[model samples]
Target: MRAVAVTAFGEEPQLMDVPQPEAGPGEVLVRMAVAGLNPVDWRIADGMLKDAGPQSFPMVLGTDGAGEVVAVGTGVRRFTVGDAVFGRFWRPAKGGGSYADLAVAGEKDVAQAPRSVTYATSAAVPTAGTSAYNLIEETRAGEGKRVLVVGATGGVGTFATQLAAGRGAEVLATARTTKADLMRNLGSAATVDHTAGPVAEQVLAAHPEGVDILIDLVSGPEEFGAMTRAVRDGGTAVSTTGAADADALTEQNLRGFNFHNRPSPQLLEILAGQLDAGRLTVLVGSEVALEEAPEALQLSRTGRARGKTVIAL
Candidate 1:
């Protein structure tokens, strides 16, 4: 089996022939069709998790993937051979990952892939979509609310915008000039150009009373403070990237928190239903072969990618 792995933290990933993984108890072996690249992939490669815990050297480097089940392990009854599934494959402790041609995931984390979308698109949905769902749920944004999504052009941001709008909130999103139309097409009622001027000023000009919910996908300390000011009193502010200040959150009448995405079988089923109903869209900007994962990972880390990039096996 061919896999791209990092022999050491901060080392370049190398494509090598490795032994194929087998299904353990309550796990299912999947013949991977595509792998999704996220910002976390590059962070892990750069040794971001070094102090947090131990990692297996020569560790495979991917979390989200879509493929067909080749075998099911003991105690697994939900899936069988030939069933199509997608989800987070790598467990932090196990070190096994979806970057390989074959990988194993616990039956609990896997869900049937949407029939409406290709495997490449389905591969892009699990992590990002689940993150978006959690963000929306945390904020409690719904009907009649004015929700703003900052950094609305990236993978999770795009899904956040659509899901917020679909929930009956008036969605306001930010993107570069090139992606303004794309953002609007995805259900944003208003779009701000982040490259043009200050994001805080642009958002305030559109909604003078402040928004009911502000979701910041990309922000630093200063940028986050400015965006937090755009949230109305009693409203919520959520950050997916670690950009919120606890002191400021207490001073102002704002609730602030960050999100770490967790995979849920129920959430995956809901997202799959949305995709099948043509209510949710997975925007895939590029598709590369498994051999090109290193390049794709770099592109995702640069924050310049317009949409999700999938690694087709």
Candidate 2:
């Protein structure tokens, strides 16, 4: 089987002929149709998470994927051969990932793919979908709440905007002018042109009382702190990039925390249900063949991505 992988951490990923992987106890082996590219995939390859856990060489570099199950291991009763599935497939310790023709994942991280969409779309949902759902739940975005989504055109941002709006929150999404219409179409009540000026200024100028919640997906610590001004006292601010100063925000009479997503099979199933009901959609900006993954990975580092990128296997 052919896969895109690095011989070692910090090495560039390349298309190589590697041995196929099989499911282990409590795992499932999937013949991948598509693999999703995420920012953390590149970061892991760069050794930023070297201390996170043990790893194996010739490590495959994809986190999410959609495909057909080819085999199941002992104790895996929920899935069978030929079942269509989508979810997390990154097992660095086993030198396995979704970039290959076949990948392995713990059963708990795999779930039935949304029947209403193609494999390409389902492949893009796991991480972004789960993150958005968990964020909305944590902040209780709903009727009467005003939620602002920073980086609202990116993968997780796109989902977050829709989910927040679907729950009846008035969504304020930050995007470039080019994506203003798209964001509104995705349910943003208003759009903030982040490129024009400070987003906090624009948001506050329109919503004087401030939003009930802030979901900061792209800012650094200083910028996140500065943006928290858009959240009213007693409101909440959540940062996905570890940019939140919890104590400092609390001192300002606002609730703040660095968000950590907890993805689960149950969440994936709910997202799939949303897709099936036509209440959710996946936005795939680019799709590359497995062989082109190397170049695609390089382009991801440019930080200009507006939507999800998928690798067709």
Candidate 3:
């Protein structure tokens, strides 16, 4: 099987002929049709998780993918051979990933791919979609609430805005001037161009009081603190990027925390429903072949991506 892999931490990724993976007990072997690129792919390649735990060398470089199940291991009953599926495929500590022709995923992490979207688009959903879902869940956002999504034009931001808006929240999204229309089309009630002025000033001017839920898709520790001030006292601020401070959260009576995205069968099912009903849009900014995955990862790491980049297998 052909795969893009990193032979060592911080080394450039390369295309190599590798052994095809086989399903183990409780796992499923998928013949990948497309693989989704995320920021983490490059982070891992650059040795970001080296101290976090052990990693398998010559690590494959992806976490999100869509493919057809070719074989199932013992105890796997949710799917059969030839079932179309999409989900996250990164090992927790070991570095094996999805940027390959074949990947082994636990049955628990795989779900039926949406019938409405193509394999490339479906491949882009799992990691970013799941993270956006987790951020929404953490904020407990819903009907009639004012939800503000900072940095709302990136991968997770795009999905977060749509999900919040779909759930009946009035979404206020932040983007560059060029992406303002795109945000509005995605269901944002209003758009703030972060490049126009300071995000804090623009947010407060739009909503005199405050927002019920604030989701920061891109923020560091200092910026996160400033954004938290825009959340109503009793409201919550959630970050997918681990930028919130716990002590400050306690002082303000505002719930603030970071969340790690967990891919679940239930969440994937809900996302599939939205996609099938034409309520959710899967945005793929670019598509490349498996051999081009290394360059794609480099671009993703720069944090300038307008939407998900997918690799066609």
Residue 90 displacement (Å), model 1: 0.7
Model 2 ranges off by over 4 Å: none
Which is better, 1 or 3, measured by lDDT?
A: 1
Ranking, TM-score, top scorer first: 2, 1, 3
lDDT for every model? Answer: 0.87, 0.92, 0.86
Task: Looking at model 3, report the run of 10 residues with the lowest lDDT sum.
Answer: 88-97
Best by TM-score: 2
User: Per-residue lDDT of 1-313 in model 1, one digit per residue for the tens?
Assistant: 8988888888898788777778889999999999988888878877878787766667788889999999999999899899999998985455657888998899989899998889998999988999999888888877999998998899899999999888888988988778889999999998988899887788888778889888999897789898887888978887877888766886897888877777798899999999999999899999988889998887777798869988888
Candidate 2 per-residue lDDT, tens place, 1-313, comes to 9999999888999999888888899999999999999887888889876887888889888899999999999999899999999999988888958899999999999899998899999999999999999999999998999999998999899999999999899999998999999999999999999999999989999989999999999999999999999999999999999999979998999988899999999999999999999989689999999999889888888878758999999
Clashing pairs in 2: none
Model 2 TM-score on a 0 to 1 scale: 0.98
Lowest lDDT 10-residue stretch of candidate 2: 297-306
